[model samples]
Target: MWLTGLLAAAALVLTAPRWLPARVVALRAKVFAKVNGDNAITFPNAQVGPERFQEVYGHPAANGRSRGAALSDLFWYWLSPGAEVHQEHLEAGPRYDDVARTTRALLSGPADELADAAARCAGRVLDELVTGRVTPVRLRDLMVPVWAEYCYELVFGEPCPRAARDLIAGHADDVVTALKCTGLRHPARRERLTRYLARRVAAGDVRRPLPASLSPAERVHYLQGTFFNTAVVQLSEAMAHLLLALAQHPEVADRLRRDPADDRYFAHVLDETLRLYPLFGIAHRITTGEIDLGGGTTFPEGTVLCFSYPDYHAAGHRDPGVFDPDRWARVPARAAHHIPFGVAANRPCPAWRLSPLALRAATAEVLRRFTLHSTVTHTRSLPNRGPCLLVRADGPPPRHLAALGAFLRVRDRWEDVWRSVVQLVLGTVMVLHARRLRLAGRYFETHDTAGCPPGHRPPDHRERAE
Candidate 1:
């Protein structure tokens, strides 16, 4: 009976989001709203439970006071994961007297350099894949290292040394790690990188001005952090997605190849690919005071807010699930809301400007060189799971074969839809079972002590008033 109830409850929670009435969802959304503010909403983390927060930040003290004074610090630390260490390093550094000038100095470079590097790297990787020169070659593996090398060259004015690659690759476990060092897990590697960067600074090869406030150690950390956080990490994933997108939509690929100089077409395709498979699926922000997000939904101060790219696109756009680059042309306003790099207001990626340029160059080169055949496989991970495509260079299929391939792609999309529905159903059933058991247990605890079996009740509770 207990097992049966548990199963039923599990199914309900899993399916609740899908089946819950629109009004209920809206009301729930309102509950997250700030008092007296319009349109701003908050995620109290109530529905999903507090486990995630506790897991990331550790549990609050027993008396409910945090170890830190500033809530924003905790919030930022939570959102960016490993950024606090880098932020600390940046803060400890000598403040650059002219931040704007320093920023300009950091960003200054001939755009063509990045483009040339991207084209070269893309050509080499695609050639290897086409010729079967490398076995078990994954697109991301090739792209990450190649892009890393290019970025190192662009930033440091020389090729990336083998040691730097080893250190960066070793530490780069995920997107956050790419941005900042989370801990002292790789102390030896960190030390080596510090020494290497310090030497580079001394040589005066790096054109980017170091803030006078930064100590030598902080300067090293800042350079390493900035280099890693820039184009390489995000662009690699975006480039992978673009390849898969082109392979699946050969019509678009053909169009791109035919008119390689059409910047609008390239931008549309990149934008659409990002929309379909964003590098980071969601962006998190904490409310500062009350915010009116319009529609009578206001979020209170300290509320943890999430902007899910997928959810926003799905709710706002027509046929949001489909990969149609043409839609961007029709709905220019929709494209404005696309935030693949990060939100502009809060934690924007420093590489946002260069990333698109590099992607455009790399993608154009790839399409020009080879006709791609690709299959996208999705992992079972929730939320963050984006499209991962397995691609092979098939040269170019014959016209008849290409038509047949397009048909199959459409059919495959339908199959994916059905698969998602079936999975949702199964997940919903499990959540329902879990919910049922929870309610049953609550009832049993509250009013049915007389019916409790021996050894089931707590020792103190087992002793009746008599």
Candidate 2:
């Protein structure tokens, strides 16, 4: 009887790789909500489906950023040192406008101009490697230096040295790793970046205007939060997703390579990649005043609204799971449910126009040099950092990538079992720690704060916006 009981326990443990991950994920989300307190409401508010995604997202009353200051704590903790000044977290008003203006100015180049710069920077970053050999590459890792140089030039009109590239890449990687719950926040690594940006800002190395409303310190943090940190992190992540998509779908890659000049095809590919794997996840806002959505539906003041980009993008489409760029031929990108960039009325991505153009250029450069291939299961939350193989484009048909892909797939599944567990532990701890730290709360208390009092919303965190 004892032997049989032990054997059963072992069997359960052995097969955990299959079932444990999903359970752990669901539990983690529950813990996350509990720790954070579910005073907020989620969007695509089931009653409406995807029909009112934009309506709620773009609503003027749903425009408050700092109102839900407790949720901001988790974000600020994860993206610390200068996270308080990250443009996305700032409340709407003159300060946001100034930061937005600076961003627009920096990203103001023509589409062709941005593309050329991106291609030039990308081509420069790709060092010569052994051809005809399968090389495992982390797409985010590869794209970081490319974007580091490109973004560096955007801030300062000179070439980025290898040293600067390393610093920028390290800072960006640390932030992304923490954001993905793969690692803990390392304030020392982030502080080093803060110091560097401080010096640059003091020296007026910032060629563009920062928020004039900020003090000297706030100016430094603004540069780090906006330019060096968020811009580099996002652009690199988007490039990784794009390259991974090309790797998984060789037909699309082959077509792109054959017609390297086809910007339209490239654009479609980018739109689809983002639609499938959006960079931003849930972007939540708190209402400053009551919002009436006609039909007698109203979201009361301080109602926390969560706009989930992944859910919104996945719904109301034909075979939303399938990766089909041809779908774009029938409908313009703007017309689709895709909001890769946020809603224009409520703080859209400042680089909306430039991001697609830069990604297209960087991808074109990559395809010109090498053929990408991957068999790893592509996921929206690519915490695996996009496993892929790079083959020289000019080389003969490469050998079996199946072995590598198979290994990655298995490794990823097991990793998910452990990673999910880690996320639960870390996410809960950080949520609690953030609540204690009250980074955003402190910032708001000192500066001008927004409307919502934490935990004052509906009956439960599970309550929805009707």
Candidate 3:
């Protein structure tokens, strides 16, 4: 049994390179054609490639479909109210009833409230980055923890459950494993979920006396796990989109810095980025009953259906294949045709509002501070592109730092020293984490062979591997 466990562990880790991202991307691509169906639109096979993703929103177009569609779906799912069908579950119970309400309260909350909270969260980090007090690598370290904390608060509500937050903060691998298993075959998801649950329970991070509304099993599914994979996936994808825009048009950042009130410009850049590279393509639903998606194609009851928001949004814009924020600016703000998150028929993201607020706050703060450099090596995901982790490029000229330095000069010297010390300590901790992953990789390679000397080599501490 133990040897079998080890083998299973190896296979689970191996799947991360393909399985995790594919789970999200595959769903997006499969639904590219069904986003909208007015029954009047038709194309005579102009769109080519996989027949599965051909007619986006029922309008047939040829030659372009990519991960950008998925990112748009993620954006919509995270921001706006879901489609009519999605609201049904929310109405079914009080537990979920608050999902949309709380989301709206947070995003469309009082402008003062949003500004104060956003500033508090971003203040120090932005200051550090702008002043060259920390490197981009160090900024990533600070940003991930801060962003994680913020997201947990949004998802679970405040006063944020300390144990749940700590479990996520300390055991990222467990969270990643559970997320990867979400839509897989039952036993596979159950196997990974069980291990994750046991670890949290052992750490005393999960409480006893499961909620009265849940059986012990149901409680474990909903409460014990965290959405750490989504956190990293979305954050990295958002960061990439933001950076890519900055790299392509230095003027956009300049305009943003000079007139911070022009929130529309920031939105345009974000929209363009998503259109070019979405995070999760489309969301899936097994049809509960027979329904006509117009155009004379009636999907029978129980048929799996999806709507491709990315395709619809891309199709409505000019040169859907290129990266251009200007095209985004040309569209109106509340246009349903943009469908970056999810549209009327197929919205799936529960974090719709929370994600955009977070992304906007983070993006606005960063752009107002530093000029990000361009990289020759780009990262391509199933849906988006990020800076190659291995590449280093010269960032935009350093003029912004001098301006920011003058602004921060009001603080006393001692306070500045303390902040720098704290940042340095955080940087060291990140270095140690990287070292741990390196060691684990080497150890796994060394022992993963036939006839190796074996006796309890402890399952490489599951949570950190993610």
Q: How badly does each model clash, as a count of residue pairs?
A: 36, 1, 25
- Candidate 1 local lDDT, 23-128, one digit each (tens): 3434433432322134322222443222222121121111111111122232233223223224311211123222223444665567887677778766755564
Between prediction 1 and prediction 3, the one with superior lDDT is 1
Total backbone clashes of candidate 1, pairs 3 or more residues apart or in separate chains: 36
For each candidate, the alpha-carbon lDDT, in order, equals: 0.50, 0.80, 0.42
Local lDDT at 6 for model 3: 100
Q: In terms of lDDT, which candidate is stronger, 2 or 3?
A: 2
Candidate 1 at 199: error in angstroms?
Answer: 3.1
**Which 10-residue window of candidate 3 scores lowest in summed lDDT?**
60-69
Point out where model 1 deviates above 4 Å. Answer: 1-82, 85-104, 124-136, 161-163, 173-192, 292-300, 333-336, 342-347, 378-466
Please provide, for model 2 over 1-466, each residue's C-alpha lDDT reduced to its tens digit, 9 standing for 90 to 100.
9999999999988888789977977887776666446567777875656888898899888888864536777888887776656788777765666667777888897778888899899998876322446678888888888988899989887788888887888888888888888787788887887788788888888777676656688778877778778899899999998889889899999999899888888888888888989988788888888988878778888877878888889887788889998888987877789999888889888888888888888888888888887877677878778888888777785556677778777887777788888877887777778889988777766555522234322122123113
* Tens-digit lDDT track of model 3 for 1-466: 9999999998876654445434534543233333322221222123321243323333312111111122223222221121111222221233233333333443345545544455445555445434443233322333544454554444333433445434444433323222222211123333453455545544545322222333344334433232343454456456655665565466876676677767677778777777666664444333334545366655454343344445544555567777677775567746524545643333235555556666667666666555554432232331112221211123444545444334333222223333334333443343334334443223325432211224423222232244
Could you tell me the C-alpha RMSD of candidate 3 in Å?
A: 17.6
TM of each candidate vs. truth: 0.59, 0.92, 0.51
1 against 2, candidate with superior lDDT: 2
lDDT of 2 at 342: 89
Candidate 2 CA-lDDT value: 0.80
**TM-score, ranked from best to worst:** 2, 1, 3
